[model samples]
Target: MPRDRPAPDLPEPLAPLIDAHTHLDACGATDAASVAAIVDRAEKVGVGRVVTVADDLAAARFAVDAANWDPRVYAATAIHPTRANVLDDATKAEIELLAGDPRTVAVGETGLDYYWPGKLEGCATVEEQVEGFRWHIDLAKRLRKPLMIHNREADHDLLAVLIDEGAPETVIFHCFSSDANMALACVEAGYVLSFSGTVSFRNARDLHEAAKLVPDDQLIVETDAPYLTPHPFRGAPNEPYCLPYTVRSLAHTRGQDPVELAEASTATARRVYRI
Candidate 1:
C-alpha cells in the first residue's frame, strides 16, 4: 500500500457544504470517536454533511454504523461492481435490509469497473458486474433513494444498463470520470455528476470540460477519501475536511464562485439523496 503523505493544511473554508460521497472506513475512521473527530474537522471547514459509501457488506455495515454514530453522517450501501462476483443471495438480502434503513440514503457506490479485471486476475467478470448493477438499480427504485454509481472505464455500459433497466428517480455518477460528451449525455438524462479530487489535477482537461458542462444544480463535489487526493497534495490522506480544495478547483473550472458552487452542490445533494 502507498504510505499516506502528511495531512495537508486546511483549505479556505466554504459555506456549509456536503461531501456527496466518501469512504470514512477506508480513510481509517473506524469507530464512533474517530468518526466524530473526522466530522469535527470537516465541520470546522464547513463541510457539514457527509455520505459515506460502501463497497461490500463489511463496509456497508460500517457506513450505517457511522451514520448512526453521528447525525451529520449518512450512508450509501452496496456491493461495488468490482466485487459483483460475490453478490450471493445472502449478501443481497443483507444489502436489501440495509438499504431500507432510513439513514441509508442511496444504493451504491455500485456500478461497473472494467479497469482492473482482464489485466488483473481475480476480478469480477463483466457479466457478474452487470447482474449486480441491475440488482442494485432495483433496490434503489424499490427503496425510493438515489442510485450512486461508480463507473470506471465502463461509461457506455453504465449508461446503457441504467437506461435499459430504467433508472431510479435520482441517479448520481460519483467521482464522474467521463469526458464532456458523456457528461452531456448524463445531463440530458437528468443524472447528477459528482466530481472528485480528480478534477483538480492539471492533467484532467477533459474532466475540467465536463465540470464546466454540468449546470450548477447538476454538479456536486466529494473527496472519495483515502484516494484521489487533489493536486499539490496528491498521494496524501484525504478526508471530508479536504473537500474545499476540490470545490474551489471545480468552481474555477465552472467559472463560478466557490461559495456559490458549494451552496449549489449542497442543495443538489440534499435534494437528490433526500437528506
Candidate 2:
C-alpha cells in the first residue's frame, strides 16, 4: 500500500539510510521499473543501499538478477530455515555455484525456526534444519563470506550450534527479536544484530531495550521488506524507502542522533555484508 501522504521530513544526515535486509524477490515488486521507483523513493528519503535476501534457489537467482539491475542493490543467497527440507543435493550444488557470483555477497536467511509446532508441508524438521544450517555455514566459510541467520524461538539451539561450529567471517542475526541476554551473548560472540521495523512497535519495549544494549558497531537496521513494516505503517507492505522510520525509532531508543545512527548502521552493514 502506498502512503497516503509523504513521509515525515528526515534530518539532513539521517536521510541516507541503508536497509541491510530486504526481499525484492519475494515482493514481486522489484522489476526494472519497480526497482527504479523504489530507488528513487529511497534516495529521496536518504536510503542509499538495499540488501535483498533470497530464500530459495529460484529467489536467489532473482536476487542476483535484481542486483544486476541496480547498482545500489546487493544480494544474499540461502535456503530458508522453513524450507530446509528442500535442500537436496542438486539444490545444494546450485547454491554453491551461485555463491561464486560477485553479486551474491552472503549465505543465508538460514537458521532455525521452531515457532511453528506443526510440520509444515515440505518443510524440514529441526534436525534437518540444523544440518542445512551447517552446510550453509560451511559454504560461507569456504567462500569467505558473511552469514545472515534467521532464528525464531530456537535461540538456545541456534547459539549452541554456532558456538560449536564456529562462525564465518561475520554472522548477522537478521530481524533480531531475542531478549537482552541473548543480545548480549551474541554481541560477546562477535555477531551482529540486525533490527527490523518490529523494533518500532510500541509493544516491542523489549526490542527497544535490546536496541539500547546493542553496541553501535554491532547494530544494523533493516526493513525485512514486504514483511515487518514499521509503526504507523505496520501491516502495510514494507519497502526499502520506509527504513528511515525504523532508524528514527532506533535512534530515539538508543538516545543517539538520527544521523549518527544512520552513519553507524551503514558502516556496520558494510562491515558485515561487505557491500
Candidate 3:
C-alpha cells in the first residue's frame, strides 16, 4: 500500500447512490468516528450508503462492529477465498454468529480465487477454496441473505461450484471481472453483477461490454474502495466517496444517464441486500 497517495477529489455529485462494497478497515478506519469521517466524505460526493465487507476473522468482526457503529454502514461477512485455509470450526461458528446480525447484509467475498495460490504465501488451494465456498453458500441460504462472491481467475471453477452447491436465492458477483459472455451466463442464471472501479479503465473493454449487457434489476454499482480506484485516479488511494467516478463510467459505457443509472443501482442494491 502506498501511504503517500491521497484520496481522489469528489466527482460531480450524482445523488443517493450506494457503494455496495468497500473496506473501511483497510481504508484506515478503526473506530466509530473514523468510519463517520470516511462516510462524511462519501456523502458529500452523493454516495450515501456503504457496505463494508470482511475478508477474515478480524475483518468480519470489525465489519459487524462498523455497521453497528453507523446507521449508513452495512456489512458483508466471510473469509475471503484466498484465506479459505483459515475457515476452521471455531471460525465458522463465530462467522455464523456474526452473519445473524441485523447489520450484516450478505454472506460473502468467499467464492473462488485461483490468482494467488503460488504467488501469495499461505494462500488456500483451489480445493480448499471450493469447500469453503460451499459452506458459505449454505450459510447464506440458511440465513436467507445474499451470497456475495469474489471471483478472480477462477470463473469456470467458480461457476461450477455454484452450480454443484446450489446457489443461494440471491448471489452477487462483487466487482465482477468477467467478459460479456460470462456476464450473460450469470444473467441467465439469475445472479446479480456488481461492478467496481476496474470497469472504468481504458483497457477494460471486456468489462465495459459486460457492463452494457446487465439488466437494471441484475446490475449493481460499487467502489471496492482502497482497491481498483476508477480511471483518472486509478492508482490513487480510494474511499467510498470515489464511487461516483465508476458510476459515471458505467453510465457512459451503457449509454444511459448517470443519475438514472445511479437510481436504478441504488434500488437494486436495496432489493438484493435488503438494506
Candidate 4:
C-alpha cells in the first residue's frame, strides 16, 4: 500500500539547531547536489547541520559520502538491529573503515528492535541482534566515538547488554521512547537521551513525563527524519527542515525556552558528534 505521505512544509523557524539523527539517503539525497539541496532547505528553517544515520551497508556508504560532500553534514553508520542478520566479516570490516572516517561521527543507529522479529520477515533474531549490538558497541569504544543506539521495545535487554559489554564512554539512545523510569536510569548512568517528534504527540504522556525529567544538558533533539514527523504535521514526509517542529515541541513539554533548548541541544550534538 502506498503511504498517503503529504508534501511536508517546514514550520516557522526558531534559533539554529542540529538534527542529531536523520536519514538523508531516504530523504531523496543521492549525491552532492541532492544532499546540498536537502540541507539548503533545512538551513532555511534553523537546522544548521544534520547527522545522516545509516541502517544498512548501502546507507552506511552513502552517509559517509554525504558527510564528505557537505560541510554541514555528518554521518553515523551501522546495520540496523532489525537487519543485523547480514552482519559478517566483510560487513564489519567495511563498517570499521567507514567508522574511522573523520567525517563519520558515531558508530550506530544500532541496537535491539524486538518489536519486529516475529512480525517482520527477514528480521534478525534476538541472538543475531545481540551479537551485532555487542560488535557495534565494541567498535564505538575502540574508535572513541559515541554509540548511537536504536532501541524499540527492548529497553531492559538494551540496558542489560550495554552493562554487559561495558558501554562506550559516550552512549546515546536515539529517538528515546521509554518511560520516566528508563529515563531516570539512563540519566543516572550518564547516558544521553535524544528525543524525537513522538514526544510531541499528546497521548505519549509517559514520554512527556520522561522528557520533563531529563537534565537540560543531557537531552538533545532529532527528527529521525523521513520518519517520526511531529504532530500537526504527523504522517507528512519528514526532513531535516522539519526539525524545528520537534525542537519547539520538546521545549514546550519540558517547560524550557525553545531558543535555549535549541542552543543547548546544538551544543550537546556538537560535543557528542564532534562536528
Instruction: Flag clash pairs in model 2.
Output: 15-46, 16-46
What tens-digit string does per-residue lDDT give for candidate 4 at 10-90?
778876799999999898889899999999999998898999999999999999999999999999999999999999899
lDDT of 2 by residue, 110-175 (tens): 999997537566667888899999999999999998899999999999989987888886999999
lDDT of 4: 0.92
lDDT (tens digit, per residue) of candidate 3 on 1-275:
33456767778899889999999999999999999999999999888999999999899999999999999999999999999999999999999999999999999879988889999999999899998999999999999999999999988888898898899999999999899999999999999999999989999989888888999999998888799898888679999998999999889999999999999999999999897
Candidate 1 vs 4: which has more lDDT: 4
Residue-pair clashes per prediction, in order, are 0, 2, 0, 0
Residue 261's lDDT in candidate 1: 90
| Full candidate order by lDDT, most accurate first | 3, 4, 1, 2
The whole-model lDDT of each prediction reads 0.91, 0.84, 0.93, 0.92
* Candidate 1 lDDT tens digits, 102-182: 899999989999898887677899999999999999999998989999999998999899989999989999999889999
Alpha-carbon RMSD to native, per candidate = 1.0, 2.5, 0.9, 1.2
Best by lDDT: 3
What's the TM for model 3? 0.98
Estimate TM-scores for all models: 0.98, 0.93, 0.98, 0.98
